[model samples]
Target: MQDMKIADLPVHDRAIDITGETCPMTFVRTRLALDSLPDGAVLLVRLKGADPRANVPRAAADQGHDLLDMFDLDDGSAILVIRKAGA
Candidate 1:
């Protein structure tokens, strides 16, 4: 099948892989990754399973980043596009 990835959705500054993890863990990993990025940079988080779909965007919003977009793939994965807020 075609790779339905976050990159295929829209332009972003960076892409992060968190495919093998679950809920809170997925959120945690995304949070840590965002820390290293400069404000205004976009992060494309790729994760497999359900929790990432529900939780990642919520976590991103809680952390002050804008949840730019989200894509649910046919292969049972999700892509969340988030933009870090300026400090």
Candidate 2:
């Protein structure tokens, strides 16, 4: 198997923007969204700032989800791709 580029990933099952959110709220919102998803669903999280850029993916992975990818957008924010853990 080969690693897919961020652009090659399938369309996300859901997407949320947390560019206006900070720290714990960033992960909080992300967790809430993940909780709403079915097992193995993919989520696209749009976030800004160093805190969220670093924390959301780490926290999601810690909670047993898969961190597919994290990459920057041209506008300065970044996108985090996560796959919900199978139940």
Candidate 3:
């Protein structure tokens, strides 16, 4: 899908908060959340720090998921919307 505003993205199927997590663990938790969903499921992940913001989406995409939308909140944390592959 073409890049769209976060507000324009579909409602998420699941959500997770990883603002307290770091690096590999950030993606690990995200991966676990994705694994629990059916293909094409949408997951919203709230994360902090530049590492997770930079890594999680790339990792999810590497694993065949689609990065639907991502945006930073006013509080400085960010959200990542991922769509599981296979739809």
Candidate 4:
């Protein structure tokens, strides 16, 4: 997989929408997807609720990939853009 350029990142990828899910489940699914990807792959995660938004990054940070960016959509939902680090 290719590392998405910063500008093109927000435009693409098959997103995982984990809305209506809480805390660990959100992180769990994200981790599972990330774990299976090769370095440079990107995962776009849409999560609801504050804890998942806040806590997921902390958990992801520990995994070595930088949480490249996050944006809150107008509908009170958030999108997290994560990129795998180091080949």
Candidate 5:
């Protein structure tokens, strides 16, 4: 991705709202979507519960994307914004 801080990321180009989606499937779908984005593209992921919150970011990071930000929303779900890396 570009040489920018997580907060410096521009508006998200895409969003994967997996609020009601279950475990492994959560990250699975996330990975699939991320793979489809172009370099430096930003994605906002809306998810619920602890498992997805804990695992998806780590997994995405491990896959070489940047976990720009992650925080809880008022409805008990959370939003994780990541900027895609590489070609």
Candidate 6:
């Protein structure tokens, strides 16, 4: 795949790696991770497959978080950079 990640982005406040996790767990972990952050805090979430690539971002947006970027890495996984919406 083409390298489309943004070169300069906001520094993430935290990171969660859910590569081996599945649907509900993927989202659950993401939600919990976001909850730990204060407003405007950025999080870097590492996940894999089409499901996570699809669901996580949508769920984050629905919950009012900012989905800053989604990048597909050479490892066949992806990175979702999200900023917590409120304190």
TM-scores, each model vs. reference: 0.83, 0.86, 0.87, 0.80, 0.85, 0.87
3 versus 4: better lDDT goes to: 3
Worst 10 residues of 2 by lDDT: 1-10
On TM-score, the candidate that comes out on top is 3
Candidates' RMSD to native: 2.3, 5.0, 4.9, 6.0, 6.6, 3.3
**What is candidate 1's lDDT per residue for 13-76, written digit by digit as tens?**
7888899887788989999989989999888898887667877887788878998877777777
Task: Give candidate 3's TM-score.
Answer: 0.87
Q: Rate the local accuracy (lDDT) of all candidates.
A: 0.81, 0.89, 0.88, 0.79, 0.85, 0.88
Model 5 pairs whose backbones collide: none
lDDT of 3 by residue, 1-87 (tens): 234465764598988999999899999999999999999989999899989999998899899999988877777888888999999
Question: Per-residue lDDT of 4-85 in model 6, one digit per residue for the tens?
Answer: 4544434778888999999989999999999988899999998998898999999999999989988777789888999899
**What value of lDDT does candidate 4 attain over all alpha carbons?**
0.79
Better of 1 and 4 by lDDT: 1
Model 5, TM vs. native: 0.85
Clashing pairs in 3: none
Which has the better TM-score: candidate 5, or candidate 6?
A: 6
User: What lDDT score goes with residue 80 in model 2?
Assistant: 92
Cα lDDT for residue 17, candidate 5: 85
Decreasing lDDT order of the candidates: 2, 3, 6, 5, 1, 4
Tens digits of per-residue lDDT for model 2 on 15-76?
Answer: 89999998999999999999999999999998999999989989999999999888777678
Q: How far is candidate 6 from the true structure (C-alpha RMSD, Å)?
A: 3.3
